[model samples]
Target: MRILLIEDDPRLNEALCCALRQEGYEVDACLNGQEGLYYMETGTADLVLLDRMLPGLSGEELLQTRRKAGDTTPVLMLTAMGTLADRVTGLDLGADDYLVKPFAMEELMARIRSLSRRGGGFHVDSGELAWGDLTLAELSCQLRGPGGECTLSRRECGLLCALLRHPRQTLGRSQLLLSVWGPDTEVEDGNLDNYIFFLRKRLKSLNSRAAIQTVRGVGYRLTMQSEDSL
Candidate 1:
């Protein structure tokens, strides 16, 4: 399926693009709402992962604009937590789903899967990921951890998906950046740091005993922790 990722954070954009590509899915991405809308206008994306607080043309406005123009493509809105009210407003504006920031990749994948199942897009996922109580249905893009549920932004989903595939191997910052973001992109290393912070927060919230360990001065690890009850 062709996926459009609309996120401003360079680290997030790069990681998501790279990870999705590795999964063999056709993906096109944008840094802001304007670029995202332009792509949507082209009718090239099967689904869109749109950030709510964008620079120009916020995600909410973008979705409403598309719908006003009679475009009904599936859209998943991304916002930081504490913005559930914002999500409801966005949904009223025409978004199909909403995901908060500090979310797991698996959760993001699950939401996409849910969208795909409804939209009937051609999916190309491997479905081989599991971390602690979390499970990733790669081909389906769904995540589950105990009873708590969360959907991932495309960027967050790809970051975690890549880490899950790598397990305890210490992926270097450069390697991770290249792997997640295509090598041709002009993103900087600082971007990777931001995503690591985002992923860590998400995992901690889902399960405090979960493992997405950072190797000082290096990259990270997404290993299974046995002590947790969940």
Candidate 2:
């Protein structure tokens, strides 16, 4: 899961980022509302943890602007103003959920999971994804075949998940870099290609015939063109 956390407080931001990563979610954070809006305009985030009070543009305004622009990425408003009217206004502004500040990490995770899964809490695993003999367990994040289970590192899992999500679509190198390593990481350039190589080797071990096709002067694609769209 990729999440954008728009919080200006350094302490809260640090806590949220650390905790969410521990739970295996990729997070990009911004210290101000303008930065948050900038990230939203530039990156693909599965959800947004927006603080209601922010400089430059308030969270309410940000949500309104995103809705006005037809961006439906889920937004969960996190604020200190815990009141019925506050919650009501947040929902009116198109927030998917509202969490008061000084909230429990477990509650935040639960809410985040609920928002990502649309309230039922199921992780929404799709039907089996196959690239030749290589198969991905969408729900389990496993790479396996008739032989047995093949282990995948954290980065490898992230890469394969992304490729499977957008099968046959050429994901740009920068996009992959940003997704695998969060915006704040100091990863050297070309790290994405290295991870791709690792992912390809793991796939091969599972007899995957799907190629991570590289486009000269561009990026890579998981070429499973023969398969139907999910």
Q: How do all models score by TM-score?
A: 0.56, 0.53
Q: All models: lDDT?
A: 0.74, 0.75
Q: Residue-wise lDDT of candidate 1 within 83-161, one digit each (tens)?
A: 6677678889898988877565445666777787774445634455776577765554456666465666555666777
RMSD of each: 9.7, 10.6
Instruction: Give candidate 2's error at residue 101 in angstroms.
Output: 1.2
Candidate 2 lDDT tens digits, 19-38: 67755688999999888998
Q: Which prediction has the highest lDDT against the true structure? A: 2
Q: What value of lDDT does candidate 2 attain over all alpha carbons? A: 0.75
Off by over 4 Å in 2: 119-230
For TM-score, the strongest prediction is 1
Candidate 1, residue 139: lDDT? 54
- Number of clashes recorded per candidate: 8, 0
